[model samples]
Target: MIKKAVIGVLCAGIALGIGIVIGHFGISSGPSWLKDVAKDVDESFIERFMAEVNTIQIQENLRELTDVPHMATTAGDEKTVQTMLRRWLDDDDGLDDAWREEYNVYLSFPDANNPNKVTVVDAANVVKHSIREKEKPYTDDQRDPDVVQPYAAYSPAGHVKGKLVYANQGKPSDYEELSKKVNLTGTIAITRYGGAGRGAKAINAAPYGVAGVLVYTDPQDINDGFMSDTNETYPHSWYLPPSGVERGSFNRDFGDLLTPYLAAKEETYRIPPENIVGIPPIPIQPIGFEDAYVLICALDGDAAPFAWQGAFNCTYNLGGPGFKPTSAFSNSDVKMDIYNQEVIKNSANVMGIIRGSVEPDRYVIYGNHRDSWVHGAIDPSSGTSVMLEITRVLGRMVKQGIWRPRRSIIFGSWGAEEFGLIGSAEYTEVISCSSFSLTLHGCSYTLEKQMFRLNKTY
Candidate 1:
């Protein structure tokens, strides 16, 4: 009996192995009619549809969205969101009401009193001092100095000047080394751009009584040489236009920085008070190494470690005068207005649908975010524009009566994606939770019969 049981188990295992192998490599030997149907769908419809994709429109949309510094919780960002919604609606070409309507999801940040406000010092001075003599000349006419100011959004406006200290990448480890070797109390810290996010550096500086924080991209980080040949040096790609490469700011963190979700309300969805989690107290800004070099050269402290060496073709140092008494340096108090107002409580998602003749309920949805950080051409507009072109082509196909899909298609252009994936996530949850029946064809003999009967009656 035991032998028989062991043999039975072996046979069951063999059967399971066979099933796995077949599932991985098996080709369906079903009806020839199904193959013919699939072939027709590909050749007659999908081929023609694919040919209509417009690359030009995709590039144009990407360039426009990423062209500016549109931070969340700002007027510029709101305008950008509305502009995308309007453009998608206008471009729908008569199929305006084919899908469900749109809605908005609100995201809140800290108010002025919150500690997240970053202080700025010598803003004009840095721009003026670094532009002509210290900074490299712009090779392209398209590069705008006004727009290129390296300031983070939500930064509290202020100006303070103190003795500057080179803090390497301004990471935790860099600070640990500074604490051990040198005293950095009551002084401004200048850091370079690589390690972690820029906000992390600013947050670190606040407790150290750091009057201000300055971040910049070193020459070794961005390029090998101080300046590159005009045409070859710029980071342009065919997939991107002249201004397509995004020189974006680094200020992203989980949850709303202005409001801290407590243990009880962590999962709850609601905007907290402004100035909850955002970095305030000290001012922070990022700059190019050219600007950083001018400040570093003026430092009167000990030389920095070998690891802190920059690509400046010079020895890296901490400061010249060494550790100074805390009383020697003075802190300048700066101030700025933090703007916070709950404006319009409405935003929308643009959606279009193409109904299926055989199975009208089974949906295949395609979507992309319409809102951008700036012009947002590449990050999302490239994909959004392509989706739009596909919609246009599919509409034309339907008009000609040459194509009839088996599954319904829903297209969406989402808003406020940069702030968070609020629009898409909310829409999905609402649709999924709502009671809506979907009819699917070619599911099984019994299911297909029911679907076909329902379609016939309707």
Candidate 2:
């Protein structure tokens, strides 16, 4: 009986040894074997694709795209679109397809023919300040003479002169207070940027019968460092310097002004002129605070409400026709004269598509406005660089057979966003228009989720 038991134990030990050897050698068969094979393929492709995204590429792309100013509707803007197209074509990630979608849309632009002028004069009619906000230097390569001046896009074209009235921020409530203090009719409104949209300031003043508007960046609104004499500017800190003027659109009504619910195409019907809530009739100009101070210091009336006071050394006041003299304008009239020329032209929108494997009808859209007020390094170029980089990575994954997204991805390089979202709004209008909807099968799109997908592990 003992001999038989010992043999049994030896057989059990041999079986365990064989099992260990098989497992170590990966000799297992069936579904587990297939899973191991699949996992190895995924790991190799994942690492390779991730390695494709790097700082060197990102830096190179940013510098290349931002090397020139590409404001919407300019020759530079078209060139920028072509450059982006070239990059997409040059990509080696084995994309399924690439192309551009062109739309003929109306864009508002400023040129030599259609221009704006803002002049500050004394009672003598001598020009005290004649400089309107022009494109100034931010970097060695950013200055472009053809770049549009600091006029509010879509502002009415007219020449009007009136007494300079210091209206704090030119918001609705500020005007409400001014109406209580003095008559606001026919006076030019002087306001600093803040408290409201720049366009809203102009719109609010129209009801008060103001002749024109002046928008500026007050030192009080800027940071302590920007207002200080000693501080680093751009390429060092993000703080805005004194000379820097913030440029933006003030199209009051929602969506595209030219083509609201319908696309801005020759074939589409447009709303009547009276029905159209388009450009404000008042002439509006945006100036740097340096120019603004020359006028703000000349203001005189009752002491401005405590909240109305700015960082300026002089006390803020609501100046109008009857105000008493306190400064340079004490003995003379402070007047503002403005002229604006509004032009309309055709602009384009560039788009790229990556079809999905499962749900091609649905989409994951990524967009960045490629147009800029200047070089747009911070506004849109930075975001454009990121979008391009993402395309490369996803392309690699698709080529390596590692990822197959459930929804299609569409990359849009929008134009004219700085001009009150013209490019995007027009695009939306085309999508919903009866004639245009036939192509998209009446597809409905929504901004379901938004994410800032960039951050360093460090």
Candidate 3:
């Protein structure tokens, strides 16, 4: 009986060894003799593809894309356009197809020769103090000539001066509270940045009789009041330096400002400049916190309510509508001189496609703006880098016929996005106006973060 049991155990052990060998081979080679037993995970191609995608390629894409500051319509932007085209059109590892779309979009720029500025002028109209037109240049990136001085884009170019009022965030409620305390008319509200859209900062102030707006980043709000000095900020730590002003489009809507309903083709009908709305009617500019500290400290009036106060050392005040008696800016008014201009320029949208094997007409579009306010290392370039890597991996695979998506994949590098989604918006108008134009007067596209995707069924 003992000898019979030993023979049965030996036979069972040999069967187990054979099963293990077949399982290993099935996993390695995919759909092998043991496929039925392994349930056919079909993970071989997926494993190979994921292995090919690595950090080094992603970093390389970032390094190449951000080599220069590529604001829309600038020469630097053209370079980036070429880079995308070259990559997508490469013979060996390129997409199935790639092309460029051009649109004549309206854009804004600060006068390069005559920079925008905020100043304190004496009652006699003599300039007493002027905030620095540009941030303190610490590195080559900051000092780059292409780094445009911080200014409110699309703010009508004009010079206006009035009493300085600390209107927190320049929201409508803020203006209402300040107006109840003191007259807000003919004042240049030095609003700290937050709680409102950049353009709304000025637009909300307009009805309260605020003539102009000077927006700035408060260290408390932006940096959590960790540190205000240059040493404690960027290049040293994560905080923004005192001179780092947040620059952005001050316009209210998306798409080409000139061609609202139509595609921004060269021959598209454009609305007259005077017909435009949703922009600050008054001149506006953004200043650094260092300059804001100087302006706010000079304000003399009743202390603001606790909620309106920020992390500044001094008590936030409803301006005496001017300056403190003890301040050097006494009897002086704040001045905002903005020399911004608007013009129609050609912006490029680089579009690439990977045709699907099953549903060729259906599409999944992945895109990021290629333009920046400055180097825009964070705003858009970071997303652009990740997108480039994705295309590289998928493009190579498609080129070699390793795998194909079920639906078409469209990669778009949009332009003039910093100016308010001009590239993507105009493209939408061209594609969707036939259907959405009659039902919806306007189509709004909001980018959730630096990147967004759309699945187009039609």
Best by lDDT: 3
Candidate 3 local Cα displacement, residue 374, angstroms: 1.0
Indicate the residue-level lDDT of 192 in model 1.
80
CA lDDT, every prediction?
0.51, 0.67, 0.83
Ranking by lDDT: 3, 2, 1
Which prediction has the highest TM-score against the true structure? 3
Provide the TM-score for each candidate, comma-separated.
Answer: 0.59, 0.80, 0.85
Over 4 Å off, model 2: 1-50, 113-115, 135-139, 228-236, 272-275, 320-326, 331-339, 432-458
Give residue 226's lDDT in candidate 3 (0 to 100). Answer: 51
Per-residue CA lDDT of model 3 for 1-458, tens digit only, reads 99999999999999999999988886656444344444444598778867777678767777887788888999889999999999998887789888898999888899999998888999898998999998888778777899888989899999889999899988889999899988988989989888989999888999988899998888888787855554677768878888888889999999898888788999898899889888989999998888888889789999988888876788888899888989999999988888998888999999888876755556676878898877767668767777777778888999888878765677888999989988888777785423211233222333423432333200
TM-score of 2: 0.80
Across 78-131, the per-residue lDDT of candidate 2 in tens digits comes to 888887787665556634555555554544454465456676566677765665
Q: Write the per-residue lDDT of candidate 1 for residues 90-200, one digit (tens) a residue.
A: 543323224333443344332334322223234242221322211233434234332323344444455555556788988878877776655666566778877866667
Per-candidate clashes, comma-separated: 37, 0, 0
Give the CA lDDT, 0 to 100, for residue 324 in model 1.
27
